[model samples]
Target: MVLIGYWLIEKLFTFEAYKTRNNRGFIIRQITHHKTKQEKERQREKLINMEKRVLYGLVVMLMYLVGGGYSQGVVEWIRDKAEWEEILVKTEIHIGVMVTSPLCGAPCDIVNDQVARFVETYGDRIKFYKINVLETLFFALDYKILTVPTVIIFKEGTINLRFESLSDWGMFYELLVNSSILDFPPDLSPAPAPAPSDSDPDADLPPPLQSGE
Candidate 1:
């Protein structure tokens, strides 16, 4: 009877130890799974950031290439028109308009290209100013320009005509030309005549023999 009792106690203790070991193994597996999940999440986040950085770099490079490829004249012309507006012979055009974007798109590019061409061709006679919607929010609101490609014609610095969307280029040019703000010939003071040439051989000739004999 004593031996049987000792054997029973030993069996119970062994079973308890086995259960404890199993429970410890389960816990370890759970922890390992959680750690692996965390590592994967971190890796995914890193990949997303790397992709964004690469995309940003590509966009920057594209901008540089486009900017660098344009002819010097085109580049200079763009700069002059953009920067010289303040100093430009403030020509009050019968047409002034606010453009909302500088981005490249179907109709946007078409409209912008036309405007740039107009500015380059008749810039001396008329002034066309463009302000980006994102950059010049205040100016847009001040002019009540709520949409892109808005055309506004100004005379004496006050709004006179406005149109949204594309329209006939000829009509716009005509309006600008007749605005009277643009000095038709551009008031250029005449340059003083070159001083009578000092090498003139005619000046030294004795007064023509008072009319032929």
Candidate 2:
């Protein structure tokens, strides 16, 4: 059988012999000192065990590549696409903030922070979703997003407001209030200035009463 012949060949020529000499020297050495029956059998078993381990490792690697790169990758892509499609179809108040990258700049950070606060304040009334323009190009194209740090608000599946560029939290709050999405207006009043302190060392001290009150 092919396996028997292959095993015989391996027993006759091993890695140790290959490292030591040319083909002529290897043949002469093999002929001069033929291994004992027990030694030959032990070498054959060792080679077979090594071959099995290598074959097993290759099979496991192949399975992992197929499962993770092909199967799971496709499944996740479909799921995410479906979720975004559903968001577009649903008739609800939804706010989508489009950004090129989450950690790109101060503008992106400010927009995210404002949206997060808005969501926390009115989460029960509206839904908020953050869309990365680079990662979700299809969604960005569908929504016609042309710039980073863009905020789009939808009411009953219609775009109610769209804002672009960096903006302060007060501006966003005012916009949401104007759109009537928020029931109550956000307090945009400037913080009161602290009263002047009497701790200044250079201040004119009251003239000491000249030894009498």
Q: How much lDDT does each candidate structure score?
A: 0.57, 0.60
Candidate with maximal lDDT: 2
Task: Please name the candidate that would achieve the greatest TM-score relative to the true structure.
Answer: 2
Q: How does model 2 score by TM-score?
A: 0.43
Candidate 1 similarity to native, TM-score: 0.38
lDDT score of model 1?
A: 0.57
RMSD of each: 17.6, 21.1
Clashing pairs in 2: none
Q: How well does candidate 2 match the true structure, expressed as C-alpha RMSD?
A: 21.1
Candidate 2 lDDT over 59-112, as tens digits, reads: 445544653312211111212567766776873555454444654454554455
Taking all chains together, each candidate's TM-score versus the true structure is 0.38, 0.43
Among all windows of 10 consecutive residues in model 2, the one with the lowest summed lDDT is: 69-78
Displacement of the residue 93 alpha carbon in candidate 1, Å: 8.6
